[model samples]
Structures are given as structure tokens and as C-alpha cells.
Target: MQAKAFDTHLFKRILKYTKPYKKRYYGVVMFAILLSVFAALRPYLLKQTVDDYIAPKDEHGLLLYISMMGIVLLLETLSQFYFVYWANWLGQDIIKDIRTKLFQHILSFRMKYFDHAPVGQLVTRSVSDIEQIARIFSQGLFMIISDILKMLVVLIFMFYMNWRLTWIVILAMPVLVYITRIFQRKMQVAFEEVRNQVANMNTFVQERVTGMKIVQLFNREAIEYEKFKDINQKHNKAWIKTILYNSIFFPIADIISSLTLGAVILYGGFHILDGDKFTTFGDLFSYTMFIGMLFNPLRQIADKFNEMQMGMIAANRVFDILDSDKDVQKDGTVIASHLKGNIRFENVVFSYNDKENVLKGINLKVNEGETIAIVGATGAGKSTIINLLNRFYEINSGAIYIDEQNINEFQMESLRQQIAIVLQDVFLFADTIHNNITLNNPNISREAVIEAAKKIGVHKFIKTLPGGYDYDVKERGVMLSSGQRQLIAFLRAYVNNPSILILDEATSSIDSYSEELIQKATEKITKNRTSIIIAHRLATIVNANKIIVMDKGQIVEEGTHQELLKREQGYYKNLYDSQFALES
Candidate 1:
């Protein structure tokens, strides 16, 4: 659906967030009513004081009336403070809830969604776009409603005191409203472009910053900066359109307001008679004040409408993410229990996108507690096998089962809890080594982590570090060596005690010393558990119980390491020769 600046459906949806804070929301509306009442009463009170007391030169209880006006001012001031405070207070909370929901929803999305999604765009939606929505509350919706109410009350008073001047003032209003309608249409389209540009800039900046090491290493800093400059230029250009609209509209609005005030003053000056109640000097003074109240808000409507438009545009983007139910992985009713290590892929076929098949029809099986090492070249569907086993992506055609039960029959969380995957590039949070291992799971204690580390033979090495497990790894475990980080990952896997373990080229890119530690850790973790190891390096899988050789997404051969090497021209034979030949 196309986005609109003032869509009632969309506006109502945004308002529903206030349901949890209905009391505060009602408080805002009540304060708005009080402000309008206070504002309208001001001119009426002044008119009475001028006509009855000041004009007639009466001194009785003049101080009391003055004090009453002062009290009204104080009450209005107090109401104003709460109005501003609660409105902003409410906005902060709404964003907090929205940000939490957005992040949580993003977390549950399948790996396929992340494969095509830009991290920066998601960040912008959660951060920048949501920030704009807050203005819808703090500066746009309630404030606009308050202004409209004040204008309505002022108009009622204007017609009551003098209908002639009231009629004259409203004559110019239709033109103002017409012009505002045009501005709204123009600004809505412009604000949408501005938001688009913002997302583009965010995506570009995020990618560049995250890959800054590559940028600097390749000496492409100047090139990247130029590209970013181009993006920023487009962003500035989009904003300039909105700025141009405001620059033209506000002045025209002001001119119309000035003309309305002028008309009221010219007519009121001619009819100011001392004794006539409607045409009295006091009535004339009240009419001028009434015009300011009425026209001032009318003047501000365009600007506030811009804020609402920006907010609605932002809401459209945010809701787009929240509404993408298609990307969320399907949930299952059954919880996995006492999972056995038996795994099978029956004629499984898969693809990231629909057109090209990444995994053609294939069948494979592994017995309970057996370790199967898959050896394949790049793009041979090595990692895809691991991904499908974990249900990261659903197979195009065929079923995967564990212990004779379909894997999809189990809840996603339950299924994953039984599996542990250690990737080639280990990712550790900017937290302590202990926190990264247990992932703050609460159930897994420090002693369990230590036991796991000791089982993996890294406990002594960890103790050598300044704070042992307490040492902050910083972002991505940059403070630790590749081998140390790998050891931490092995410790994590050991602690999980998963029914199935998959190591996807885990030691391929690491230092030899780290590779040695990982090999030892692998031996400890794989015992008495099903393990699937995907490796490019042939020497690492020589001792596997069985070996599966893949070529072009199809399994070509399956046997023990020595049996595969015995074939005259087998895919595994060639791969093993080339890999070990280089090592020799």
C-alpha cells in the first residue's frame, strides 16, 4: 500500500501504542482542553476588567479580579508543564517498546532474510525512523489537536462579541486551507524521499565502517569517501526540497495571518464606541487578541503537518518490517526431547533464491554417535548441508529427519538447542570470555564453563590471561589470538553438550598452533556425540569414521578416508592429493 501523510488508518494504528498508557494519553487531552479554555478566558476576563472596572473607573474589588487572573495564569502554566512533560514522557516509552519489539522480531527472522538484508537499513528503522515517530506524539499530533481546539474556542468568542469582524476574518481562511492542502501533498512526497535518502546513507556508512579494515588495506579510503559524499549529497538534496517548501509556505502563511489581523483591526477601529457593548474599546481589544489566537495556530498547522508527515512516513517503513510475517520461520508444536544422534537427508534439494538450485537432489545418512566429515571444493554445497540440517533454510524438495522423526516436527528453538555449530570466523560479543561462552544463559554456571574449558584442554591457557574468563574480549574477541578465540568457541560447544555438532571449516583460516588446539578440542567434543565436519583441508579429516565427497551440490562418493583415496579417479582422491601435495 502507498503511504499517506495523514492516513486515518495509519494514524489510528500509531495511536494504539498509547493503549497501555491510556491514562497519560487522556491526561494530555484534558490538559489541551484546559489550555484552550484558559486561553479563551484570558480575552474574556480582560474585556470584563476593561469594560466594567477600568473603563467605568470603579475601584471595588479590582485587586481580587487581578489576583484571580493571576491564579488562572498559574494554573495554565502548571498545566502546560505537565502537558509537555507527559507528552514527551509518553513518546520515550512508546519508542522504547517499539525498538524492543523491532529488535526481537528481527532476531527471529530466518538466515535467508539476513542474507539479502542490509544491516544498516535495519538499524535505521530501529533507531532513526523510530525517533521520527516520537515527534508524532511530542510535537505533532496532540499539539496540533491543541492548536485546533484553541482556534475553535477563539472563533466562538469572536462571533459572540462581534459577528461582522468574525465573518471578515474567516473569509481568508478557505484560501489558507487550500494552500495548506497543496503544501501537504508536496511535502509528503518530499519527506518520503528524505527518509529514503537517510536509509541509503545509513546502509552505505554501516557497510563501510564495518569493512573499514578492508577499505584501509586496499587503500580505497578516498574512493569510499567519494561514494559516501555522493550519497550525502543526495540526502542533502532531498532535505532541501522540504526546506524549500517550508521557506515558501511559512512566509505566505504569515502574510495571510497579517492580512487577517489587519482586516480585524481596520474594522474594529471604526466601530469602537465607549457605551456600545459589542463595539466598545474593550470588545475591540478582545477581537484583536482573538484573531491572534485563531490565525497563529492556523499558521503553525503547515509546519506541524510536516512533522506528522515525516512521522507517518517513518511509521510506514517501521511497520513494513513488523508486518513481514513471510520472513519469519515457521514454528512447530513438538519440543525436542532426549534427541538421539541419528541424522538423515532424504533427496534434499535447496536454494537461497528460487531460480538457481544450490543443493540438488541428494540423500545422506549418519548413524548414532558417528562422525562424518564432508570434503568438497568451494561452492560444492559443503556449508549448505550444515545449514539445512539446522533448518536455517528449508529444503526445496525432501525431508530431513533425526531418529526417524521429521526435523520440522520440532520447535525451532528446541531443534537448535540440540545442535552446536562452530563457524570458521568465530563471533564473540564485546563482553567477558565467560559471558560469551554461556551467552548469559543463567542456567550455565561459571564452573560448568570452566569444566568445559578444562575438558577441551584450554583451562591452563585461559588462566595465563590477565583476568582468565573475566578478561573482556572486546568486540569480536579482538583482544585474543585466533587460536585463543577458537579455544573459547570449543569451550562454548562443549558446555552446550549438544546432541549434534557441526564444525564448518572451523580451523581452515586459523594459525597452525590454534588449529592444533582446535583439533584436540574437536576430539574431546565429538566423542559420544554425532559430528559433521566440513573441511577444505584434507589432513584434518583423515581419521573420520566415514567421509562424504561432494561435487556441484551432489554427493559423488562416500567411504572411509583411505577407501576414498584408493579410487583411481575419484573426486575425493583428486581433492586429497592436491590438498596434501601442497602440505608435503
Candidate 2:
């Protein structure tokens, strides 16, 4: 999001999250190893059954050999089951832990991060990206280990049975390895391209759907379709390349194995005719089975290797978020219960990046129960002040104090709990109206919710709905008007009954009628609270105890509304005059 150069060290960072479940993870790996060992044993026993039990037809030998084979099969099945279950459980557990940590890390990032980053990308990283990495743990890594172990066991047994014959099979392995390596590299690049293209398609779909209304209004549906089609074609091409390489890879591996198997039968058949006891009829059958066995695992291992490489690319992205620097973190200490709601900013100089400061050296103080209104143009750092006050972003150079204590010294959660902000853009969850208002805060009683709604004049409107407070606010509150959503937001902020209240363009979206009611509600809510309001309309803050007009992050004017109107110069006068012109 910050366009921070891609750091390939993310995979190492991800391994740290597996620390908590290392014991279970190791148990799963051990299980998989045992499963592989047992899997190889079954084939070896087939050879033994043919040579010793079936051919000889000795009664005691037959019974004992059948029992041993049955036992081997039983153990293999049980071990395979546990291996799969444990590996899957370990993968799921690790992913849960990773997601929790990633969620917290994302929340702790500065708002500026969200400004530059797409919501769709973050969603993909949190959900799909982690899933891909988890697949690497459960299926990709597990298959890889099992395949290699099976190949090794088969080779070891084959050589012990007949070294000269084994050499032919072993010789083909190097060539097989070389071909597989080349195929894996090609597949990895192709799949990585496919994955990237899919992500682009995801972003496109998300943006287009969210902006569907705008697209239709401008008659750009055809254009959007074309854009999506182009991205889809790119994705299809990438997938085609991946499929083509993968299709060739397995067959090539099979052919190489076939050549080796032919050599084994030819060489071993001649040796048996030459009266070599080791190269019996049963031995020839086993040798052929072993050669065939190597092909599947070898090919599977190559496929898993390619899959794991794709997952590694995703893991790199997921871990990038997990290991990102915490732009905002909680202080270990808690806020005093008797916090007096006094706030002071001393020489705050802030910048999102190093190039230019958003907020220059500035100072301000608001005593307990004082009402301060901030007025200026859109980019006057008004919202930045609120963000800093909430400890959402740290200043580059400054000290901010809350209740006579440096704000940073108090626990961030405690400090934020003391403040309530009604933002210009309100977001309501897809839940019941009551749950939305209460927001899972244990302290927020049902009575408080009703009271807040009543005070904000949302009670009457909500009651008109089918279920009143129980009515669902559907996705993004699409079921409600902008004004209704604003009222709901106001009630939510007020339900907290915080020591400090911030109305950030709080009434900017409501109509005149709703604005009047909100103004009255704000007056009652602001009483006896440390209040900061950012207003565009001059009439909204005419009665404020003090109005601080900011221009380019600096306070250019400060006084009561009457005092600013008298001055008739600077940002406040210009804003007032512009609003006056618009109204008239």
C-alpha cells in the first residue's frame, strides 16, 4: 500500500507464527513420515507374498503371511488417516492464529495506509492468501514429504534386491530430476502469473460492483464489460500456460519411468535365465511395480513443488502484512479512572511521509467541558487532528497530553474509550439496529441504546420499521436513507457517553430538516463534554465557545463567530461568505 519495495523476507517472518503450535505440527510431520514408511512396506510385502507364501504353498507360512499382510494394511490405513487429520488440523490452527494477528496488525496501521490500499486487496490477503499458504502446510508440504520419502524407500529396496538392475532405474532419476526441475520452474512462473491475473480480476469485479450505480448512470456498462473481459482473457492465457506445462510434465515423467522399467525387465529377465537366484519371477514383478511406483510419487512431488512455489508467493504477501511496522500501538499503562478530559497539543509537526508536513508546528489546548469548533477548507488537516487525538496516527514531532498525562503514556484502548466520534461518512454493520447501536460493549445497556436513539430522534423512525430496534440494517445500511444513517451513527457515538466528543462533519450529509434536529441533538450531547466539531457550514458552529479556522494545517484565525465575521478576512470569512452566497 505504501508502495514499499517488496521485501522477500516475509516467509521467514511467517514461520514465527507457527511457534505456538510447534509441538502438534511436529507430531503431524512424524505421523506423515510413519504413513510414508507404511505405504512403502505394503509394496514390499506384495513381493514377499508372491515369492514366499503363494509360490511355496506351505500351510503355516501362508496363514502367518496373510495375517502379516492384513496387519500391515491396517496400520497403513490408520497411520494415513491420522497423518491427514493432524496435518489438516495443524494447517487450520496455524491459519486461525495468523488471521487474528493479521487483523490486529491491519487495524493498527495508520488511516493513510487504507487511503492508498484497496479494500479488495486487503480482503484477498486476509482470506484467500492465507488459505493458499495453509494449503502449502497441509497438502503441499505434506505431499512433498510423502512423495520424497516413498521414492527413497522404493529406491533403497530396489537396489538391495538387485544392485545392477537398480542402477538402470537410478540412472534415469538424474534425467528425471532435471526434466522435473525445468517443468517445475516453468509451472511456478506460469501459476504465479495466473494468480496475479486472478487478483487483478478480483479487484476489477469488486470496484465495478461497488460502483455499479455510477457505471450505469454514465452508460459505461459496455466499457466495464470490455475491461473485465480483457482481464479474464489474461487470466485464461496464464492458466493455459500453466495447464500446458503441467500436462507435459507428468507424461514426460511417465515416459522416463517407462524407459527405466523396460531396462529393469530386460536386464532382470536375462539375469534370471542366467540362473541368478535373486532375479526370480516374483522379483521381476516387484521390480516392475517399484519402477511404476516411483513415477507417480516423483510426478506428484514435482506438482506439489510447483504448488508450494505458488503458495510461497502468496505467503510472502500475507507475511508482509503480519510483519509490517505497527504505525499505532497501545501503551502498556491504563487511563486513570478520574480522567479530567483536558487535551493539549504542543508544537505538533506531522507528515504522512518525509516530503512535506501535513500539520506544521501548531499548539492548542481544550479544558474540561469546553466546546471547540474547527472550520476550514476540506484539506485543512481537520480530520488529521481527530485522527491524532484518537491515537490513530503518531505525530512526527509533537507531544499531546490528555488529562495532564502525555497521551502516549496512557493505554491506547483506554484513551480511545474515553472519546466518541461521529464521522461525516457513517458505516453501519449488517446487523440488527440494537446490536449496531450497542456494538457489543458490555457497558452499553439496552436502556442506554433506547435513550441514545430517542435523544438523536432515531427512535420514532426505527419504530416505524417492522421489528423496531431488531430490524436489520442490511449491507452498508442500504435500507436506510443518508439522513437515517446519520441519525443511527449519532446514536451510536452518543451511546458510549464518552468524556470527549468529536463531530467530524457530522451533519454534512443530512438534509436541512435532519440538520436542524441533529444540531439540537449535538447541543444536548456536547453539554459538559470536551467537544471538537469540524464544520463546513458557518451556521453550524455560530454558537461555539471558540472557532479555530485552519489553512494548510496552520490555524489562521481563532475567535468567536461574531469576532470572525467582524474581521471579514482569512479562511473563516471566506468560508462564511461562500456559504452565505450559496444559501442566498
Candidate 3:
């Protein structure tokens, strides 16, 4: 019922990802072919020894034949060993390559893509999906080739011994193929359901763990447990159906194989007694052994058919992500030679989706070495403006220029490197304070990190902890207070020393005393750079060089603090009055 994910176009495209491993893949194929040939040789040699040497008591012939068979088997074992070892290595490397590319591709997508997609589903597509593909490549693909080769070799030898006897044995071939096709179709449906249920279970676990504190506070443990149990039960039921189909397939194939063996024995025995045959006792004995060898591989191929189909579906999903176009792509072969920190937005129109506009024909400009404040009601597109400037999303129409050159003309990485943003919501990795501050910048020294921390007023507080800069902030920096986290976020932004800075309510979470400290540090940080602050508290930005008032995605007013305050009939006056009333 879910739209078919098994797109042939996507499958062929994904095969291109294997181009780098051609040598290893060829090695696996050669080894499988050799192993199959050697495996088929063993029964034929045994039959010759049993029918001729053992019956006539020819000691020399028996020893020579047994020794040759032993050597063949030893070589086969060695071949299998390398096949498994190198095949595993190759499969892992391919998955690693695919996952690395997939991860980078997802990161390159526009912010709206992440906003609309689930984090857990992305994680599953990256990890679980790739793993499924690897299993098919390593086990399913290699085994299939080997089994088919071995089956063909056995069938050839069986017919060579006696064509009439071989036909008697293979009369069941049509039925075997028919039954395997049915099982393939049935198990494909059931196994696909199993895979979907597993992904759902994964999503459930991720969500519950992320919100565990909220669940505990509300005392909804039992309810959450019941929900998880229901999901788990669905997964269990899907798996049961898969097992049931698989279990029925092998037995049915086995019954048919047994019937073939019985027919061979009865028919071949009659020919031997009548002396009206194209086969001898030894030939019939060897032929039946060859027929027996075909069963295991045939049955295995039937089983792995299900794995192949599931893997194809997963590969299609993964490649779909990898093949997605970058909507916020860079352009031109030019790089910005100089950035003077000046920024201008020219009649920009933008939206996450085109159906509705988040920012409608907004125009504004900021000079180098100036501080501009943006104040507005919630959902008034303040942060959306920041998102546009940073090129997290492309404008629907109109151009934004930096120092007179359109920002889109410069390479994306180079443009972003010159800018830094400190948001109201701070996120810290579960790592040490030093790593969090430097953020793995190889060129950033410890002294530089500490200086940035001191400038932002987090140095003294960090040193008071027992581990100092080595202190670990677990899980989004939950170990620190809101103000402390804000200070760290500021230091992170300041450590980069960008030419342009965007501070979106950087001091909104701190108390008055800490806010005063932050205000001093902020003023020092923004002195000679372009600063755009989305101020939550109007007082913080009252001293800004310019203040822009926005309403419903339009900039209705723009001027210095004194100029805007003196204006008649503006949104700035009402905002200032309401905040003053609330504080008083």
C-alpha cells in the first residue's frame, strides 16, 4: 500500500557507487567460481573410488584417489576462507563510502528539509538502511552466484552420466522453480513489513528517550510503556509472518527434492538390472550425489531471494536522499576577494514553501562597523531574515549583496566562513569545554579560547569547576545553567572573529547582572564589525546605531533609537511602552 520504493532507475544509479571496488568484487567472483568447481569435483572422485578401487581391492588406486580428493578439499577450504575475509572487508568499505557520502549529502540540503523531516528517520536511513544493503552485497549476492554456478555444474555432470536418469531427476524442476517464485513474492511482502515495523520501533525509542524527563514529570510511564509494547508487538507479528513463509518454503522444496531422489533410485536401479541402460552402477551413484548437491544451493537461493528484494528497496531509499538536489547551492567560479562587513538586502521575497511568504519584499542595509537591532512580535520573520543572510535558505526572488557583490556569486563555504551567529537557543555537544569552545578548530589555540571566554565573561566561572576547561558538558550542556550556556555560546561565536556577526537575543536568558556583563562583552565584540541583533528585550538594543521595526514580514520602520522613538504612529513606540510597563 505504501508506494513502491523499488525504482529500477534508482537501483541502476546506486550501482555506480560500486565503481571504486571493481578489483575486490572481481576477486570475490573468481573465488566463488573456484570454490563451486572444487565442491562439485569431490562427489565424482568419491564415486570412482567406491565403485572401482574399493570393490576390486586396488590399494594403490584408492590411496592416490583419496589423496587427490583431500588436496582438493584443502584448497577449497582455503579459497572459502579468503572469500569470506576479503568479501567482508569489501562490503564494509562500500558501506562506509556510501554512508559517508549520504551523511554529507544530507548536511548539504536546505534547512527546510531538516525542519520537515524526522531526526530518527534520518538516522535509520543512514545506519540501518546501509547495513541492510551491505548484508545483501556480502552474503546474498556472493552466495547467489556461487549457488547458481554449483547447481549448473552438478546438473551438467548428472546428465553426462546418464541423460535418461538426469531427466527423471529433473522432472520436478518446473515445480521447484514455481514454488520458489511464490515463496519469493510472499516473503518479500512479509519481510518488507518487518523492516518498516523495525524503523517505527526505532523512532518510538528515540522519541521516548529524548523526552524521558517530560514523561517522568507527568507520571506517564505506564502509558509510554504500553505504546512501546504495541509497536514491539507489531514488529513481532511481522517477523512471525516472515518466519512462517520461510519455514514453509524449505520443507516444500525438501519434499519435492526427496521425490526426485526416489525416482532416480527406482529408475536407475531398473536400468542396471536390465542391462538396457546408458549408465553403470557407479554412474548412477555419482549422478544421485550430484543431484543431492543441487538441493542445498537451490534452497539457499530461494531463501536469499527475499533478502535481495528488501535490500533493493533500502538502497533505493538511501540513493533517493543522496541524489537530492541542493536547493541552496553555490554559484559562479568566483570567490570574494574582500569582505568589508557591509550587507544589503534588496527587495527580497522568501518562503520555506512557495505557497505562502515568510518575508515579503523586505529591504534593509547595514554598514561596516555598525550595530542594527531588529525587534518584532513572534512569527514576524526576524529569525527568517537571519536564515536568509546566512544562506541557510535561498530567497525566492531578489538578491542580497555583501560589500557590493551578490552573496550567491561567491562560493558557499567562503561566504559562510566570514559570518558568525549566536542564537538564543544554545546547543553544546556532549564533550569537554575546550572542544566545545574551540569546536575542533585546529588553528585555535588554548590561550585564544581562554581569551574569548574571558571576553565573554565565562572564564572565571569555567575555572571554578574542578576540571576547569576539561569539564565535560553532558547531553546538550545540561550540566550548566542557562546563563552559563549562553556565555559559552557567545564565546563559540566570538572565537571565530568573523567580519559579520548576527546575535539573535543573545542576552535574553541571562539575569540582569549577567546581562550587564554580556552587554559590555557584546559591545566590545561588535565595535568594528557588522552586527545584526534580533532583540527580545527592547532595552538591550535601545542604544543600537539603528533599529528596524518589522510587522507581518514587512519592515515598516527603520532609524536610529532617537529617530524611531520620536516618530509618530509606529510599532516601535508600542513595543517600547509594553516592555516598560511589564518591567515596572
Best-fitting candidate, measured by lDDT? Answer: 1
lDDT of 1 by residue, 479-569 (tens): 9977788778877877988999999888888888778878888887888899999999988988889999898899999999989889998
Candidate models: Cα lDDT each: 0.87, 0.81, 0.83
Which tens-of-lDDT digit does each residue in 370-471 have in candidate 2?
A: 899998888889999999988777788989888778888887777787898999988889998888787878888888788777876778888998899999
Candidate 3 segments exceeding 4 Å error: 1-11, 217-223, 273-288, 326-328
Better of 2 and 3 by TM-score: 3
Q: For candidate 2, what is the TM-score?
A: 0.92
lDDT per residue as tens, model 3, 73-106: 9988988887887677777887899899898888
Q: What is the TM-score of each candidate against the true structure?
A: 0.96, 0.92, 0.94
TM-score of 1: 0.96
Q: What is the Cα-based TM-score of model 3?
A: 0.94
All candidates: CA RMSD in angstroms? 1.7, 3.1, 2.3
**Residue 563 accuracy (lDDT) in model 1:** 93
Model 2: how far residue 241 lies from native, Å: 2.1
Query: Any residue pairs clashing in model 1, and if so which?
Result: none
**Native-to-model Cα distance after best TM-score fit, residue 508 in candidate 1, in Å:** 0.4
